[model samples]
Target: MSENRQIAQEIIEAVGGKDNIVSAAHCATRLRMMVKDKEKIDLQKVENIDKVKGAFFNSGQFQIILGTGTVNRIYDEVRQLGVTGTTKAEHAKEAAKSGNAFQRAVRSFGDVFVPIIPVLVATGLFMGLRGLVMQEKILASFGLTPDHISENFILFTQVLTDTAFIFLPALIAWSTFRVFGGTSVIGLVLGLMLVSPALPNAWAVAGGDAQPIMFLGFIPVLGYQGSVLPAFIAGVIGAKLEQKIRKRVPETLDLILTPFLTLLVMIILALFVIGPVFHTVEELILAGTVAVLELPFGLSGLFIGFVHQIIVITGVHHIFNLLEIQLLEKFGSNPFNAIITCAIAAQGGAALAVGLKTKSKKLKALALPSSLSAFLGITEPAIFGVNLRYVKPFIMGLIGGAAGGFAASIFGLKATGMAITVIPGTLLYLNGQILLYLFVNLIAIGVAFALTWTFGYTENLKQQIENDSKAA
Candidate 1:
């Protein structure tokens, strides 16, 4: 193999090696990688590779987009290595070694986050529809307000929405083991330890004290329920332990004895060491979050809230997502989470403005319905049909989005529950801050209207008059 091929081979090995791969392809900037199982992919190894930027999966494809200019070379090398749709038996003999701590950590990050995107969207949409149903009195007819049926539905959705994050360490554990060239089942046990109710309370104090529970000389790992790092670290320790025990055990007894011992040792360490360390980190991060929120509200909101729409438009919003989810898991609520709310509102406002102001029947028709959808917290219609189509609408939306974001930030608005629409989403902040979120959404709406009316509408009118004069 050439030098590049060697590098490519290493990259493949890093991403769970050839045996773990099921298929691969590339388009423009991303290598569309697919594994027989998402759990088996080693995200950390892939990310640590030189030239690799970030990895995320969407739909069914595990997308590995290199920073820039490296996609082609990597694509070529992967194909050359026969990872291109190679069968399991073909690469079985060439399986690489399970990676170390860093690699498993990386894998844990990817595994925990990527698969959850679809769920996030679904949850967002479901929440949005819930708001609509409530607003329109669709559910009121059923007498569902805090009633048994309503309570049950709410609980079910909340659990589903929270489950992925709450047990994230466990999820990460499964993926980490797969990446480490072992069965994911072992990682699942470690994950269970991280989130088990029986574990000492990291967030609760025993006896008139502020200190969290300690488990057998180890401080309890409190936030591991929605974390990736703790279990990821635990998996590395577990993998190492499994390897050692497997080596000493007799072949006949190895299968049963190795796993039995490995699970016990790993779980103990997780409870005693890895879990506590992660819990400490969790406490610190949560503290830092509160500290940052204490900054001048307007300035903080003006920057992140306003620019969030642009960030999403540029397709780099996932970077923000990483921050938001972490903050949510640790802090129980995130003040900055309203940026997405601002973004959706901004798009809707701009699209609505365009619908009202535009003379082009086609433009008005397209923007009108989509803008309505955006107001309800569905931006796909607005983004695809209106904002992306007309440069002015998108720009106007950005301006309004920023203004709204700043407004929400200044007021320190928070979503009481997970949702899509600004109104229902603002329930958490209702105490006096609700007014602020409302003001922000309104400002976003007004600014989009004013800008679109002044720019897109006037320009269109000017062209119409000129054409009429010419026709005369």
Candidate 2:
């Protein structure tokens, strides 16, 4: 057998043999397994296995840090050993079984929002480009003024950037409906009604150029353009309402009447009640986030930066994605991105220190590449794999992250984008602030590295070789 296959076999044996595995999945850098009984397996033996970097249990899965290149191979080997594997949906379902109400809400929000993140990423890239092209120097370099730019060119770019936010309600409604077991097409139709041309455009109403039309002579209604919660609530109500309505209708008519009544009832509820109430709620949430960001002298940034990775570890961090999208929509920039970048950088720095200081060759092999991936904005390898395993280095990383986050807020650092960070995030600051962005990364990395190397390292470095020896 190949060396990795040998290691994979050992991994199966180490984890209470193949019968203990209920399900398995792999993300970019870890082998995630949901096993039947915790007491049946030996975590120490798993750690001791050759080619394994680290292991930890999170959100109902025993995740082994196998890195990207190796995880797939090991995962495939285990699957061939005749155990049934699970999908991401199963993972989500498993995660749902384990959290508190707040954690469950956050994970559900992740299930709804993760599908929407890609388009937002694409839009953020365009926002950065728009910033790039609008620069006076760039326009001058191209021998054009703002007014001299063709209207057609401007309109095309505006469509590219604005479509996501303008129709964000539709996307959320669709995804939320899918998650809640509804027919997505009808959910989309209901979502479109919330933003249709027939209603007063929300931005225009807010800007005083238009007014909400009074529905039923007393209820005021306007377009829910760029709205989030109204669509989400509408989707849930519509979906559940459809299931309930379907039971009373005849089977032959069920197909036709179910979706029809679902959309119709939802449209009324959305326009008259859900839209008005949740729009207010969303505004409050947005305002709350703004108030936090506006806190005196970077306290908000420092607090968020320090705890952000800890939030990530809990697997509930997508709650802040709502705040972030709101920030980008209202302010046209996000300082949260800067704070998060610092948190990610600090993780990289701590991992690098672990890689450098450890006398064990296995530690060296895992930590260095994991550190590189962490610097590039993927921190699971560095955090779960290296720093968190060591304990103190992770704490040092939080301190470093806090320092970077405080500096980010004090400096008023802003990103024109969301989602991309560390290496790829350089795109967001290309409008003459790239140097400051790099500087933030440097400060985060330098402080984290210095502190971890200085105090985070323990004398137990030689023990990992015995615990996880390769030449077995």
Best by lDDT: 2
TM-score, every prediction: 0.55, 0.94
Candidate 2 lDDT, tens digit per residue, 348-456? 9999998998877777887899899888888987887678877889999998898888888888889987988888988888877788888888888989999999988
> In candidate 1, how many clashes are counted?
6
Per-residue CA lDDT of model 1 for 1-472, tens digit only, reads 6766766886788667788777776654567666667787766556444445346544345666452356778877888888774433233212222245444333345444555555544544444444444442444677655343466777776775566676767777776676555667888877877777765443344232345455555454343566645776787677777888888999999989988998888877877777767756756765665666566746666666566766554443544445555666655456666756886788888888777766655556556776776787666557655675456777787777778777776766765334346655654454345567777788878887678677744676536533533442
- State the weakest 10-residue window (summed lDDT) of model 2: 463-472
Candidate 2 segments whose C-alpha is farther than 4 A from its true place:
216-218, 460-472
Tell me the lDDT of model 1 at 1.
62
CA shift of 184, model 2, Å: 1.5
> With candidate 1 superimposed using the best TM-score fit, by how many Å does residue 84's alpha carbon deviate from the native?
15
The number of the candidate with the highest TM-score is 2
Show the lowest summed lDDT stretch of 10 residues, model 1: 89-98
Global fold similarity of model 1 (TM-score): 0.55
